[model samples]
Target: MTTENKGIVQRALAGLIETGDVNTLASFLSDDFLHHRSDATTSTKAEWLAAVHAALGPTAGMQVEILHLLADTDHVVVHSRRRLPDAGPEIVVVDVLRVADGLIAEVWEIIEPVAQTAVNAAWWEPARL
Candidate 1:
């Protein structure tokens, strides 16, 4: 079911980088998985993990909210929000990923810092996912 596949992607986004979970996260992605970021930077799965580890430290914790998650046979779009420890700013991210054989093969993501006080967290939200 597409929704079930979407659930997998959602869980990956939430728990991928946490302690004792990176390997499980890897299993959800293809070896050639690529991530395209809003900053115009791109990275492979390993590179991404290394980058996050560097930025947030080896043992960073985060809180995630799956605001929206939508999927089809080949792709899923997740609008998720996260707040990290050693806190910088609240971030709202929209990740559009292509899934193949039940694994994420490619992703295009946009991340924005939520204002201290804002009416809507994201740029915009679809009526329904």
Candidate 2:
């Protein structure tokens, strides 16, 4: 079910940050997996792993906190916030993923700096209506 796919994403994030081993995520990703980033960059599984390695500096030392997760059929969306150790401000990330055969086939992610004054709002919020 879609909820299980959300768990897959959770596991993948934890695996990536905890183990820093791309192969640890094999159970979650399909061989043809594709990741689409906020910058509009698209990459295959290998390419994405390479990028992750470079960005996270080999060990990929990081931690993630899930703020929200939503699943609709084959689509899963996750919103998380995390901060590097004394390095920079907190970063908020929104990841949208598509799962097939119980594995992630595609992903799109939006990353942004969390503004100190920014308040979380929902589209259906009464004030926004």
Best by TM-score: 2
Best by lDDT: 2
* Candidate 1 C-alpha RMSD relative to the actual structure: 5.7
Please give the RMSD to the true structure for each candidate, in Å.
5.7, 4.2
Candidate 1, which ten residues in sequence have the lowest lDDT sum? Answer: 116-125
User: Model 2: per-residue lDDT, tens digit, 67-117?
Assistant: 888898899998988776557677888889999998889989888777642
> Alpha-carbon error at 56 in model 2, in Å?
4.8
Each candidate: what lDDT? 0.76, 0.79
TM-score of 1: 0.74
Off by over 4 Å in 1: 14-20, 53-58, 116-129
Worst 10 residues of 2 by lDDT: 115-124
TM-score of each: 0.74, 0.75
- How far out, in Å, is residue 96 in model 2? 0.3
